[model samples]
Target: MSEKVTVLVAGSWGTALASVLADNGLQVTVWARSEEQVAEMNQQHTNTKYLPDAVLSTQITATSDLAAAMDGTKAVVIVAPSKAMRQVCSDLKPYYHPDMLCIHATKGFETKTLKRMSTVISEELGCLESDVVVLSGPSHAEEVVKRLPTTVVVASHNAKAAAAAQSLFMNEDYFRVYTNLDLVGVELAGALKNIIALGAGMVDGLGFGDNAKAALLTRGLAEMVRVGSEMGANPLTFSGLAGIGDLMVTASSQHSRNWRAGYMLGQGKSLDEVMASMNMVVEGIRTTEAARDISLKYNVQMPIAEQLYHVLFEQSDPRTAVETLMGRNPKNEMEVMKLETWQQWHS
Candidate 1:
């Protein structure tokens, strides 16, 4: 028998995951933030506003009331935007059970504290490290909802919690789940990739070819690993599905809001203009700040992340940032390998 799970997803990704779980025979209750979204899910059995074409199964219930939606849930998957996670979880905490295996699918750090999604979940829900989990990978909601083959990683300090989440989402058909014990590495990898995805999008928008994109992604991976290591994450996690896998998807896929935002910037659109046109919150905008702060805090050198930060926040000219990056003194790629080795040997 399939275990029933309750999911809290206020956006398209959450809706998409709920759809996948329901399709796999797990009963799910999704908390829709808006009355309109709730109505569409409950009455129409479809999220017309966000997921217009896909039909949500009747087994998944959508509700506006927080307590009502969370009642009797076996486990919880929180999929709201990172910026909104604190408030949402705070509101739900009165009803959140300590025994619940709380899993987060949202990627991006909390700007004020620079806390990763799992950390935020830990704070808001008052849960111990063992109770928190994160699931991430190179997944796009538009693709995942369509039953496209997608693989994701589930990470937790406690293997039991990770296994619980692994069992909930794994299947032979459209979705697959891999497990990891590095929660910090997984969450940092998930958050940091958005910044690189922005960089990749800029390259594409500037009409740079595959060669340029390949270079950007490669360096981007190095930068992500560098900063993540500084933050005490396992460097090997960067080579896994949560790291390289997510970087590839967010950087190249059209379904990525961060990639699209960076592409618009590359095309010379002002940040305000690009933001005005986007219906969903592009996490890259906030992540750029967190990554920049993390670099300074850890004394890590992340030229690409820093440059993209300037482009996004400081209003640095995209063309100029690109020029500056290319003009930097040429160095051997061995620096990256050396740093990785040092991290492993030192710690």
Candidate 2:
């Protein structure tokens, strides 16, 4: 099985996952947009620009050619940023096999359609929902590549697809991949958590104490459940790996680019300024917009998401948005539980 699997990853996260699979004795190929990174990974066995200090397996092959990298792959893990996903998939569509399992690790929604990464894969590859799987959780690329203790979840409506994806990444030493049946909840939790992580980063950057960060995380989870539940997702999924797990890692970890973007915003940098300087993708910026639209479409109130959206696009002051969140209408904890009213929860 190890010798049969091939992977398609474009960035550090993809490269890291490929390396992990390679370490597990699977044949992995990483597709990099830059020839330099590909050459470095192929010749030196290191992706110094992205995963510096982490050595890749000799079995792992890196290439700049997308079709060549994707050739004969059993599973293709689309790991590029959300904005680039469409174009990448478009280029590979002509070569995609119907039987190939399309997996995505990108934790973001498309800016134009607010579509999840899996949706983009399905649309581009002309595959059914069952043919797509999403693998996401608290695992960060930098840490996972270092063999750090990390857990992640693979979700798909098709149980067999989920199980196959789980087998691809699960390892006793480094990555412990779990399986879930709630594709909507898992993908939503993974994508929306980045917005909360950005807010958390802003709170910390403003020199706020843990109390403030804690409040943000808690409220953020409530908002996530609200939006996700309205979209026919299992609310309990928010408490699991792809939800709370992702939130914890993205909001607090230094490796998180979205958190860093918010932190810079708190420190008085403009959105454009921060975006221009950061080389990595701050998924929250785009997710914030999509979340704002989602909140309105579902008639859900996501104050935190709204505030972040204003700060990000509407040019509202971050400090002012924080004040707004702090002084919102007071309500009991059960106020959030009401959001699940649209659909009855038997459990």
Candidate 3:
């Protein structure tokens, strides 16, 4: 009866979630790549580099040894960045077993293969893609570590896996977890919204009024639903927490790395300078590229994402990108939403 829970990587989100599990009275182990981070988490009971304000629970420990961290754990939470996901999962492959419930909080796609995080994890773990659960929403690690009220979703094609994830992270007071069977929808919503958040930040950085941001969010959601539905995701999921809810928070908050990075970009900084200053992975940079490819593959119209790709990669001016988007031929909003019907939700 191995009930041990382990969180791979000691990043902000991973440490924050480890805190939740530790608070729940579960013995949690956080695996770190740096021995110094591991020693800091174990000795100082603080992860000052990532989470400076809070002290970690004694129930949680960390290790640099991959095998030692993963040994005999029934539940494993992988929170590596998208760029490191495959390699991290590959590193975990030998220690992986069929019985482990692999729940991943990593958002964004593997741009190289244009595969979802679940697809990457399942391939490395030799498990069904449905066996990997995706945890996402507007939850920021900074607030989540402070025990602030936050809600998120855990989606999997496997009901029991989703249920187990719901049970593992749901906090009665501060953190709320919802279960969704639409794995595709949850992943896409979580990944795609970052691109919109980047645009929202650029709007703010450009000193555009709320009117512009509101329009961006509204239309951004439409684009999210448009691409998601094309990829076999339910349109209604966009209306829920993973979609609009996550979009609002990411777009508005300074705590969001993507938004902050975009703000720098809008302030006339080069992409390299923005990346160098953030000292963190701004997921939108990579996601914008991945989403562009996804849209082209699906043959869907994603004007916003398209412009963002150019602005980010092609060195197109931010103002010019906005103008390009504004100049596009108009189509009726509803006419574009070819879902079964938007009327069903209102009925």
| True-structure RMSD for candidate 3 | 1.9
Q: Is 2 or 3 the stronger prediction by lDDT? A: 3
Where does model 2 exceed 4 Å of error?
Answer: 1-4, 337-343
lDDT: which candidate is best?
3
Task: Output the lDDT of residue 176, model 3.
Answer: 96
Superposed on all Cα atoms, the candidates' RMSDs to the truth, in angstroms, are 1.7, 1.6, 1.9
Supply the global lDDT for candidate 2. Answer: 0.86
Every model's TM-score: 0.96, 0.96, 0.96
| Deviation of model 1 at 60, angstroms | 1.1
Residue-by-residue lDDT tens digits, candidate 1, 1-347: 56667788757899888988888898889987788888878898888667778887898888888888887788899998999999988988998988888999999999988988887888888898656999999898888888999999999999999998998899789899999999999999999999999999999999988998899899889888878777877888999999999998899888899999999999999899999999998998899988888888878888998898889888999989988888999887856644655557457
lDDT of 3 by residue, 52-99 (tens): 898999999999999998887879999999999999999999999988
Clashes of each: 0, 0, 0
Q: In model 1, which range of ten residues has the least summed lDDT?
A: 337-346
- lDDT on C-alpha atoms for all candidate structures: 0.87, 0.86, 0.90
TM value for model 1: 0.96
**What residue runs in model 3 are displaced by over 4 Å at the alpha carbon?**
339-347
Clashing pairs in 2: none
Query: Which wins on lDDT, candidate 1 or candidate 3?
Result: 3
